[model samples]
Target chain A: MAVYTEVTDEALAEFLTHYNIGSMVAFRGIAEGVENSNYALKTTQGDFILTLYEKRVDPADLPWFLGLMEHLAAHGLSCPLPVRARDGKNLNPLAGKIAAITTFLPGVWPRRVLVEHCEPLGAALAKLHLTGAGFAPTRANALAPDAWAELLAKSAPRADSVQPGLGGELAQMLHGIVANWPRNLPTGHIHADLFPDNVFFLDGEISGLIDFYFACTDIYAYDIAICLNAWCFEKDFSFNVTKSRALLRGYMAHRALSEAETAALPVLAQGAAMRFLLTRLYDWLNTPPGAMVTPKDPLDYYRRLRFHNAAQGPAAYGL
Target chain B: MAVYTEVTDEALAEFLTHYNIGSMVAFRGIAEGVENSNYALKTTQGDFILTLYEKRVDPADLPWFLGLMEHLAAHGLSCPLPVRARDGKNLNPLAGKIAAITTFLPGVWPRRVLVEHCEPLGAALAKLHLTGAGFAPTRANALAPDAWAELLAKSAPRADSVQPGLGGELAQMLHGIVANWPRNLPTGHIHADLFPDNVFFLDGEISGLIDFYFACTDIYAYDIAICLNAWCFEKDFSFNVTKSRALLRGYMAHRALSEAETAALPVLAQGAAMRFLLTRLYDWLNTPPGAMVTPKDPLDYYRRLRFHNAAQGPAAYGL
Candidate 1:
């Protein structure tokens, strides 16, 4: 639901002159992507997505994101391929923001996570990790264990306003995560924010994955940890062992997990939960009074953090 | 930018069981209509628009609206035709809201209203009036003259808060409009809200007309009067007589304006301006705090009302 910048007809027509995608037939601002403005564009050539990167996205890091998508797509991963203009550059300037066009992938993101969805998602996640090994660029995870202390500090003061004693619980959790965070095990490009909305399913299979803004170089098993939190949790904040087993089985079928990786899954899962909780808490306390997007409930992640705190080992995750 | 109701994947799949439009391939919530939840839906058959009518729209009038689009599209107007399901129903229930699918209309809405755009808009508008004559169902314009008094009364208290002496000025204007509003001037179905966004263009020609939620039975000349205010105003709020003349000329090429309708243009235009001003003023004053949608500036229409106030006759409109 973001269209922060309005692209005038004159500006768009001039911009399209550099593209060989034929004349524009239809263009619409789509309610996709929180950090950038996205438009579903149709032309005489075909359908595409025109994204205007808002200030939230760093222009310097755009090439890495675009390059990652291009690389993965070229290696047979299902993702949006950046459509280069006649100038052979995928990135350009439009409406005072960096803009690019990408081929439209066909699929609807599953609104309700199903047992059937977890297997395809797991396989896709493993394949993404495998294919991304050859990509040259390296971007450090911004919300890694090292950043949690700073985030928790920023969010601590007013977090109790959301719920009494919430800030104190988060501080305690952050202490534990920083102490036991995994190190030096299977590093590569991981979709750090592979939430259900980012994975598209078609004909009962994962057709495409999108929104790589949170993607960076991290332990491959940490990606699995993120998914265990995102996809294996029910609405009641209860962990579904069946879904977790399906997801893990699918991942293992593609690439076997090392013993060290398996041993660290609990801590990695706790760290992943901490990362989201801290950010959500920060956003809950600091979102502008009238911002369009509602801050996600931090308490959801807090409940998951509590679950991780009580878990014994990888057996708790049904791994 | 509305997706008020979230349609689950299961609900959508079950809903699609009734349609012959093939298996769902893609669905993205479109940031288009303000009063409804719209999604750009792709299927194995073709592309279409899925509209979920929000509570704001009267459910009883759904037939009239959908029927009118079907009627106009069947008669060769390039509007979206409602896609009927296997049960021969165009409207159904989805996510506890009334939903319908329509063939996607192709073309982009002009962001900058140009003189070249006005002529085609005028011709298309006239054609719409002509073609709408044979439609069976009739809907009275809900925002007509009778509704103005209530709207102004609702907005009058906070009017001066927006601008000094604005309340007094609006009261005076309302008096004049009520006294001189025309009666019985070639009544027919009219697109009462044919602003620039509702008209789409491609290849220097008008391709389609859309958003029939505001369509109703009203004076045909009043629709022209609405267009004159909508398409003939420059950004600086000055009347563009050249564009007005082009629009009127293109309109007359299709259907001649009778003397009575011509004589009533000034008051009709003033009423049109007042209609928008009062509604915008109401919204400006009544918008809830932290509402997602921003209230449009009422002063824009206040300026247009002032322009209509000084006009002596139809000649002032460059007719």
Candidate 2:
């Protein structure tokens, strides 16, 4: 829940003058995305989302994110299309931050991961990967295996503060992931953070996907590995193989997984778990005093990493 | 900016089953109201606001508040009307809190008050009071003159912590206000808090009024006095008499002010300032450390109180 920047009325009115969407009828700061200030905006034309990129987002990558959405939408993918101003620019300045408007997609994110949701989610993920293959631009996954050692070094010092000897466990896990991580699998654009909250479902079908800020070029199977950790885990840290099987089956229906991709799933899943654990540990350690956003429990990923550490290849994930 | 209650998908789905508003398409917790968890809900039927009352509001008053909205909207006021469920109940339970849905009104609150906004605001206030006259239920203004002394006593001990010697000045002001507050003026239901943020405008017209949690029975002129301090004050802490004159003229056009009401405007305005100053000071002193919502600066009201203290009766307010 965040609205870090306050957009003034004068600045908003001035910003709207650049659009052909007619005068603003309503605008509200919505408690949605964590990295940006989002307003659920309604104009005489229609409803849209006005997002002011916050400091956490690198300004240089905004064109890539916006352009990726436009590219995906043009190819008939269900995603928010960046609305261009009358000046023909999708990105503009407002409230001392780069701002953009996008068409509002109507769907609620699933809070409870139903077994039926996995098929559509898996299908959408494969479609996103296939559709994004031809996009001209590329960005490296910042949280990939190579970056885990740096993350652990920063977070390992205080890991025991959250749980006794947790730092040593994380270091061992990071070392194993970095040494054995797959490098030969198929690579393409992946939603690196495809958490349940990022996917929207309507009428029990995947209606749209959002939060492309985490999109980056990475191993395609690694994206599937992220979903295995994100969608197949229960609150008690237990794996649900039924959900995993459904998700993998859904993806394979759209694009067949190569033999190398299937074989590398275990290490890839472990690396994926390590990626989240390190980041969550870093956030847990560095969250400022009185910060509004509560950091996710790094231990949840620690438990998942433990499972991946004990896994007997891709069969453990029901792949 | 608050969403105090977390509404789970299972609970929300169950809640929506009671309404014929169609299946839930989208639901997002909006950062609009401070007192409750407000979700911008979109169903197959249409858009609406779903509010879950937090602990700040009394549960017993839900009927009065919801009924008042129904009554006012029925009387042609452009405000959000409560949407009853299929069982014909507007108030229901959700997430262990009293929750209700209301029609979504389209308009943005003025972050920067303009002189032109004063006329429409004044006319709307008067119309609210007039239409609210026949509503049978009555709620006493909890922050009226009688409550000022208690509020000051609670805040005075640390008043100097905010501003040196502020406590003594507040005590003296409270004494003057309690002794001089008008009792014979015309009385009716009043929107005790008509700050700029609560009034929505579109195309320079007052499109809607909202946040009626503070509405209660009080002297009619006292409500005008609150508006005088709210709408007529510029950011620099200077009073804009032209705007004040237009506001008063607009109100008088709707319902003429009695001579006694006119004579008491200065004292009433001072009391209104004192009322807000004391509450703000209490909130400032008592806000828990690291609270998400920042308390307003009590000094702004202190300055307005000082202005009213030296004013030359109604003419000073552009009456």
Per-candidate iRMS values, in order, are: 1.8, 2.2
- Best by the TM-score measure: 1
Candidate 2 runs further than 4 Å off = A152-161, A164-169, A284-292, B149-172, B281-292
lDDT of each: 0.89, 0.88
TM-score of 2: 0.92
lDDT of 2 by residue, A1-319 (tens): 7788888777898999998888898988887667789999998888899999988789999999998899999998999999999989999999999999999998888778988889888899999999999898999887887888888899777889999998887788778778887777899998898888888887788878998998899999999999999999998989999999999999999999998999888889899888888888898888774565667788899899889888988889786
Q: What's the distance in Å from true for residue A43, model 1?
A: 1.6
- Give the DockQ (C-alpha) for candidate 1: 0.63
**What are the runs in model 1 whose C-alpha is more than 4 Å off?**
B156-160, B164-168, B289-291
**How does residue B94 of candidate 2 score in lDDT?**
97
Task: For candidate 2, list the clashing residue pairs, or say none.
Answer: none
The digit string of per-residue lDDT tens for model 1 on B213-238 reads: 98999899999999999999998999
